[model samples]
Target chain A: MEKPQFDLQQAISRSIQDLYEQGTITNSDRHELQAHLEDSAEGLITTGLSEEEAFLIAQKRLGRPELLNEEYAKVNHNLRTDKTWALLLAGFAAISTFIALISYSGSIYYYLLERFGLSNYTWPVVAFLCLQSTLFLFIALKKREVSNFLRDQVEMNPLRSIVFSFTLLALVKGMQIAVLRYLPKSFSYPASTIYGFQGDKLIEFATYVSLFCLFVSLLSIFFSLRSPTKGTWRAAFEKPSIAFLMLFGIGTACFAASTRSLSGLLPVPMHFTLFGLVYLMGAALISYYNENSKLHLFFFGIFGFCAELGVGVVADIDRAQRGIGQIYTPFFILSLIVGLMAGWYMGNMLRGKDAIPSR
Target chain B: MKEISKELMASSLAPIILLILRRQESYGYEIIQEIERLSGKKLAVAEGTLYPILKKMEAKEWIAATWKTGSTGKERRYYALTQKGHIELDSQYEQWNFLHDLINTLWKSPNLTYNRL
Candidate 1:
């Protein structure tokens, strides 16, 4: 009696169905299996067994399909739940640092305003130094935890995160200064006097700080983009660097144009535009950094948006009371919407469903 | 015929598992038995190692599993190949075969001796 010939196609089809029924094979896996069976069919057919037998034999040689399915499922679940928590913690820590900065600002400003008087030439200088020091200290203290948390959340590259964050900060501050310069005289308040420094001295000091930040940010970006280590820094610079650079350049040009048009004095629109650009970029960067974790994006978006909005509202409220009109409302709404959308989109794009390696 | 390292064993295990389920849905013991029989008892995977790999593959969306009542009325998790698993197996097999053939060729090269008196 002759043995029944093996039907490779039927065997593969049956196996695929069984796996699918078992919840082992997903849609993507099904497609992959079909392709594999097609490729291996010829080799199986060359064996003495019929096409089906050969395919079955080849598959048997491949191993137990259930084991692979189970392992993959376990890894994905851990990443989604456990890894997600780690990312959230990291994001919270980052947000806390920003809060600490705001706290420090309030403390310094009030302390200087009450003690040395807001008009004292030395108050702004002292306040600025104090604020910078406070921020630096807070970051240094929380650096390790934040870094580890960030590392856990966004697996691609570490240096990229650092570069992205720093670059975003500089771009934001630079735009802010340019906008302030271009705003109308009515909007112009002596920022230096508000802080308590001589206007010329405050401007010189701010220029130095901004220049330093820009240089450091650029260097970090270069290393991150070109790094062979493939750390977070590298990942951070991968896609967003182009967008960031483009926006930064355009922002600077707008600032310069506004300044030049207004005879080197900054206008209110320019200031608003700069703040909008910075806030949007910062939110976007945070979203990108925490791409694997949605909670981070949500928290950062809310906090950053509210902060910018509060500032805009306060700046416009005085004018509103006097019936000078609500100029800041439209810009404020537009900025908030754009910032939120960008952050949300970036977060989603980064948080792909692909299985990452189990740590 | 050399013993496979843990990493190599782990990587190759996915294809081996898929091939077994192609015939019929099988529980852990039966699949293990089949692999032992096919490999001529050269491969004996511990339960701890085997279970983790199965879970990982499932997570990757490569294969699927379900519990079935055994003859003794106890539930046993049976796994089978999904379409994706089949494709992965084929690709992995091709690569494995290519590498195996290349290694074999290198191993079987004639001794480099010429015109010795």
Candidate 2:
């Protein structure tokens, strides 16, 4: 077979894409460079050169990805990569704000659970989760709103971004508390173990509900940094069916087999702790796509921190407060950094096996 | 005519770009062509490296750019000088004039020129 002739247009596109992937150029930068390349080639062609020759010369003159990247990097001092720490700080602030909100609203939720003649505090939360999941699924099917919402988030001023985000968080928790708190103050307490969990399980139910909601928010922030796509769910490293199955299976298995469980570590469950490992791997699996971009696994930190907050909520309900060790809080962050570095390495390796070229 | 040193060519690009944009709005390729035309091809710019300079100047607010459709129906990033750019160009012109006057006087004095060389 004769050697294949490469399409120079495609070659230039690939080179520009490489520049983007290398963080030498952004989407707009790629557009600008692509326009430059085409214009340069056209000018060359008008000078009596053949199209292929023009393209070859133009492409050569445009320089290598590494060189272009260095030049662009020198110019683009405000690149998002420089803001990684700042974004991580914002995530941490949100997590702290969430923890405080849950604590502040605890008494109100407890009172309403008793006042409504309701023995089931958790059923409402389960209902909320079901509703949220339904909306997510609908959005996934429709493939529009989640990405549009995230695009709006990226355009938000980074300073005011955190304030607006936490306000939304406060509004959500506040409204729920208000509805439950202000419900007609007349009914007697019920004596039933049906529907969701009974009153005795209230604390556990609340902890999980709070943790789930916090994770959803952290995930939103994390995914907000991604290139806008159709739905928030698609940014998921693994589909929930796969991730939940894998995580739930491993969690259940470990929780079942553990000789000493649940108490010695204060409030941290062996099962959810297992989820940390599973999620880190899941995080690693997707890290390749975000590798050259900003936030470099800091969102994994956010996700991990969300899990760590579960410990706080549970420990607050327990006889042993502050749980585990003196530096338990720091440990959560350490897990984030260490876990992400490990996962990022693993993800890069996984990326190497991908048929599509790494971005 | 002797070619300007590439190092000199590179250092002087920012002012030249500012000057060209001050004339009217132009995109990267057109700016390069304009620079080449004015220099009579004596100043050979590394075309690939010009963009980063443009980008840097844009970042500094010396120039502003917008994507516009040209008469040829092609979209190009047309860059125009900003108020800051005008101020910068004036400042650069004054500095260049001072340097040019200093060099002229030095050249007129044979002993000083030879000693400096």
Candidate 3:
């Protein structure tokens, strides 16, 4: 027969652990409570009680784990408002929202657009177009105020800043989708046609031209509106244009070199153009928001991850619809490396003595 | 003797705990044990309820806490009375005494008489 012995310490520990598992008390609180409970158990044991009896009495005297946790949480209410919990809650909310959106897409979409007079595509198009107009206006009319605002107010925690920039891009993408899907007739732009060889060549040319034009126009606007300062032409190295050019050049070269292995997996030039545009925008946003080098690296890593995830999700959805399967692609690793180099070059440029470091 | 009512127990907890800390710095477990020893097990104070009250006092700067190794070789959070806490305990003691005296005076009378309003 087994001896009538019990692990009193383990019993107390397990009970206290239940509180932390329930998310009522934090780890520190759990540690403190455990020590206190151990002390209580020790006292009870010394008072001529058996280990099992002492453990039982001590546990009872401490009251229910749930109640104790509630009391502790009430005391540490401010500590309970940690950002990690907020992030977790936000993730849950996003998942639930996606489920709802997918489940009731037709009804929700119709109600939002028809009854509310806010067609997703039309509204996003008008809103973003207005935003673009306002941005250009601010650059042209109130250049100093706009520039000053960007310089002064853009500083934030690096992780938070990257999340904000990513969210902003996501919003822009949503608007773009709205315009394409719902208000395509509003614009007489030629529809994208993916054909065999010649059509792919046409797309490649168009993408390249669009990317170049977009970069040049944005850089010209930014430089023109920025406050006038005394510096040599070399000072231009600190500007976002230099970083964008470096990223574009390096990214394009890597894509060109890997074209043989990647051609079967993707339309190489098209993806290259898109990656260049996205990386340029992401780098500028990071520099504009934060002057931290490590954050630039982090931003690039996250950007690469988002790019890969976006491509995978799109491919999966297309495959599901067309009954086709996807081939394995390791091209994202190349994108990741390009993103890191881009961020590194950008960080060095911004931090270099040639440019006036705002942060 | 009857068990102390929760309302009365709650009203007296701060003053009792503060007075205990004023005498000597004490951790939660030791403090609870001291109270039990003083009350001869008649007044049962739940350890769970003690922590929130202690935290509230700490938040108010009436008590400050420090962690120290106990006799059992485990870290224990010991709380001591602040100057503000000392003053608060004195005032609460006065209130408790006054209430005690009034209750005693009322109970001492064999028969109580009241006029109808």
Docking class of 3: medium
Better of 2 and 3 by lDDT: 2
Model 3 alpha-carbon drift over 4 Å, by segment: A1-5, A83-359, B110-117
Best by lDDT: 2
Residue pairs that clash (backbone atoms under 3 angstroms), model 3: A121-A178
The most accurate candidate by DockQ is: 2
lDDT of 3 by residue, A134-206 (tens): 5554444443344333322222232453455456555644655564565333221232222122223323333
Local accuracy of candidate 1 as per-residue lDDT tens digits, B1-117? 448787888778877887787677776556666887898888866432455567667767677887666676545566777888888878888988999886776677656334431
lDDT of 2 by residue, A264-324 (tens): 4345544345434644654565565555422534443443455556654455456345353
Per-residue lDDT, model 3, residue A246, is 51
CA lDDT of each prediction against the hidden true structure: 0.52, 0.60, 0.58
As for DockQ, the candidate ahead, 1 or 3, is 3
CA deviation > 4 Å runs, candidate 2: A1-31, A41-60, A65-75, A78-156, A175-359, B1-6, B37-43, B55-64, B73-75, B82-117
RMSD of every prediction: 22.6, 12.1, 22.4
Q: Which stretches of candidate 1 lie over 4 Å from their true place?
A: A1-76, A89-97, A103-107, A110-114, A117-146, A149-242, A250-359, B2-117
Candidate 1 Cα lDDT to native = 0.52
Ranking by DockQ: 2, 3, 1
Candidate 3: global Cα-lDDT?
Answer: 0.58
lDDT score of residue A239 within candidate 1: 44
Candidate 1 or 3, higher TM-score?
3
